[model samples]
Target: MYKIISEETDKSGMKVLNIDKSDLIELMEDYKDRKYFLSSITGVDMKDHIDVIYHLHNFDKNDYICVKVSTTDEKVPSITKLWKAAIVDEREQYDLMGITFEGHDNLRRILLPDDWVGHPLRKDYDLNKVQYVSVDRDGNEHVSFDDKEGW
Candidate 1:
């Protein structure tokens, strides 16, 4: 339950939007309806969940808007309705982060295989490590990663 989206400049003097998931589509539509171009869509993981951010720019007005939607829900609503470029971005998030875009046209893995085990962008995730280990110094063992390899 985030509040209204802001269009003010931050410490860097660049306008940014602190958008909530619910208001994502509306914000995107506002820019698209004004003939803005889709700039980018990226994902950020907050340990507990993932957030997909969309950036749009209206060259004529020199204005840019950012829209963010969380992926904690069982299904995240798609913004492809407002910006077609969202399709690829959302797919990339889903593939690597396990985020699902419910209203997307083709919600499939974009970068990883369909059978990927877990979200890779999470802070707790280990890239090249897998399984448990016991340090001889303390003789205390713990399972850090799941059963994969090289852990």
Candidate 2:
């Protein structure tokens, strides 16, 4: 159900498939019988759209495939049902890249605090606008809101 907009192999000999967002789950499910393991899920902010890449590997065949889906919308389908290992990766993407996983069971911040203002990993995030917690030598906890620029 997915169209391959582009397909190429990198220098490392990995097959990269650029597919539509709607066909991600279906394409993955089709290869489920072949025991393709979910290696990782990564998100990139491309200004106009966010790119979500799913890296899969077949240990038995020593083959690898990277599926890429570009979407302007923040929400995407969660493939946690197909691969249970995606729970953490998807949640981290939601937290950092501000992408929402519609069917995710626990789509909360895996790294940042719940009260954090913005997604730090996004290109638009302003470090100077952030307020973080600090501690004093007297063992006093304090919230510091400074004009600190970039990390």
Best by TM-score: 2
Q: Where does the lowest 10-residue lDDT sum fall in candidate 1?
A: 142-151
Please name the candidate that would achieve the greatest lDDT relative to the true structure: 2
> lDDT for each of the candidates?
0.69, 0.84
lDDT of 1 by residue, 79-119 (tens): 77877787898888787766777788899877654445567
Give me the displacement of residue 55 in model 2, in angstroms: 0.3
RMSD of 1: 9.2
TM-score of each: 0.70, 0.85
Q: What are the runs in model 2 whose C-alpha is more than 4 Å off?
A: 134-151
lDDT for model 1, on a 0 to 1 scale? 0.69
Off by over 4 Å in 1: 1-8, 129-151
lDDT of 1 at 127: 76
